[model samples]
Target: MRHSRILADVGAALRFYSRIPVPAGAAEDAFAPPNLKRIAYAVPLAGAVIGLAGAAILIGAHALGLPNLVAAILAVLTCVLLTGALHEDGLADTADGFGGGASRLRRLEIMRDSRIGSYGACALVFSLLLRVALLDGLLALSPTRAALALIAAASLSRAAGMLLLEFLPPARADGASAAAGQPGADAAVRSALVGALLATLLIVPSTGVGATLMAIGLSVLALFAMTRLSNRLIGGQTGDVAGAVQQLCEIAFLMGVLIYARPH
Candidate 1:
């Protein structure tokens, strides 16, 4: 019973940050957990739910003989629904911050503004286009493989987000990232290893061990590049940097799939 209550409280925290509304009195203490250990687990669990929804949409679209374009739209829409567009907004804000500002303070100020900028617009478009294109390509493979890939990508990308939080300092004194900064390095490392193991198990059986290795390697490279960029741009990382990492890692995984997955 106590465990259930804790999980509910954690769920409320997740919903709160993700901008999804929960019922009143469901769980009031936002920081009751006071540690991000559960959050590390929660993130991938949420991703799994979102990924399952996306897989269902893809499978349904395919059965209906829907065009790749339509399937892509549905898949993206599913993500939007599940995450409430939280990460997308983060990506846009990060883009505006990095692309428009001359100094760290200016960039941080830009990111805080509600108005979207040209850089944000371009980043959103590119990110969506990349996701859609890669998903469409994946769907061309066997349905089972596509479904597994969706789940793996969603889960692992979120795990990547948690990884950034573990190693990087909060760029801002008070922001979403700071609030999520309760996970210790050990917990983050364990979650990351678990996520990687799950991804490897899922992808290797379907796409071959070679493809799985390639995907994991590319994801690592993407993570390194993103972390370096975050340090250069903001002196460390914020929640936005975590979002950017997830987005880039997802792209890297897709690119790996394209390079390795045999054409149908």
Candidate 2:
């Protein structure tokens, strides 16, 4: 019963977080609207699933003799496809809203517009470039290590993003963030522990203790910076803000791992 409940939560999380189809019998409530508070513990599991898919492509491309850059690009494309670019869209919208709007109301309105602006376009481009470059660098070091890094980064960044939902009130009363609701403190802690466990198991094995610690520290700093920015700029977090935070933290994690990774 306990194991079944965990599976249900993971299935619900993947259904909520990805474009990947959850078959009808995957779980009893897999298709239901997620209770974000209750299923928060499974967010990292969902991220791990997404990351695993991307890692498969990355390893496959490398096995096919593709250049590291090409392999990294394919891996990133796979992740974007799996999530339907959900967080990417959020990051773009947040960039457009925060960079272009002068007021909180205007910012929320801009985010809701769904139209890509100059800021949004730039953010997307930079985000893609950075991920590809970072992954390429890791791949050049070792494909196995790179795959591990991808999974760890994905899980950790998502856990970091959940902190916003735990700590900040919804910025908009009518949007998805508010409607989906916040996680309880216990739920938040579970999410963090799951993410941290994945990172410790994956990153420490591949990146070494020093690099793994650095990666986690950088991810935390990135999360802190995003939280503060969201609070000061918009008075609280929207879904877009959480998404942007994830993107930033992912990049930061990879950067830390790469910088501190032992000479290969």
Candidate 3:
């Protein structure tokens, strides 16, 4: 890819995935960023940027003499704000629809509703608690290691989401996700490869190669489980399903990292 095309792809991915603003004239510029659906391979690049921002907040808090718990909370909040809780909202809606709906159609209906249900609330609460707790533990090990893990988790989780989009057609005829359409296999593989490379960068440096391989194994398994569960519940996938997969992948990635904790 030309350097210009590469930058535009990153810009498009960043614009789609995060609240961060793109260049002032990216839209009207000659480059004209590619469609999001066509550029799934860039998801990991966008995720790495978001992860770095969150890590900065975490490390900054710790440098300021804050408690690890407090620093972890700050980092979590930073991520939520940076991404506008895009994936988190998707996770909540997916949980509400799948947990409370009586039928497949009903589940799809519930997922599209803007209002949150009891199931959604509970899912959000539980997921947030797990993320915060895990981050706190990771931060205790070392700020740098925790930061790298955040990058890996975010990148790989989004990569997993791309896989969901690649393999499963949209559940509904129309929606943001549906309109984007299913991703091609090559696009999905490229996205996943990017995620793997980034995850390896995070793991191989300090923890060794086994840790890198194990984290990928855990993340891919979680992706498979989530994909199966979504298919069973709704007969297909949706944007919410992608979000849920990202959140689940992040958790699984973190869980794997926790197994090799080394405080420094």
lDDT scores in order: 0.76, 0.88, 0.85
Model 3 poorest 10 in a row by lDDT: 24-33
| Global CA lDDT computed for model 1 | 0.76
lDDT string, candidate 2, 1-264, tens digits: 399788777878888889888754533555455788878989998899999999999999999999999999999999999999999999999999999999999998999998999999999999999999999988888898889999999998888878878889999898888878888788888898999899999988777998889889999998888888888888999989888988988899888888877646
* TM-score list, all predictions: 0.89, 0.96, 0.94
Clashing pairs in 3: none
Writing each residue's lDDT as its tens digit, candidate 1 over 1-264 gives 287764564465456444445453543564443356655655665565567788889888978999876787798778777777778888899999999989999999998887899999898899889888888887777767777777778777877888888777889988878865747887788668766877888898888877787877888888888888888988888887788788788778767766788854
Q: What's the count of clashing pairs in each model shown?
A: 0, 0, 0
Residue 201 lDDT in candidate 2: 97
Model 3 stretches with alpha carbons more than 4 Å out? 24-37
Q: After superposition, how far is residue 179 of candidate 1 from its true place, in Å?
A: 2.0
Top-scoring candidate (TM-score): 2
lDDT of 3 by residue, 135-194 (tens): 898887877878888888989999999999887878888887777777788888999999
Off by over 4 Å in 2: 24-32
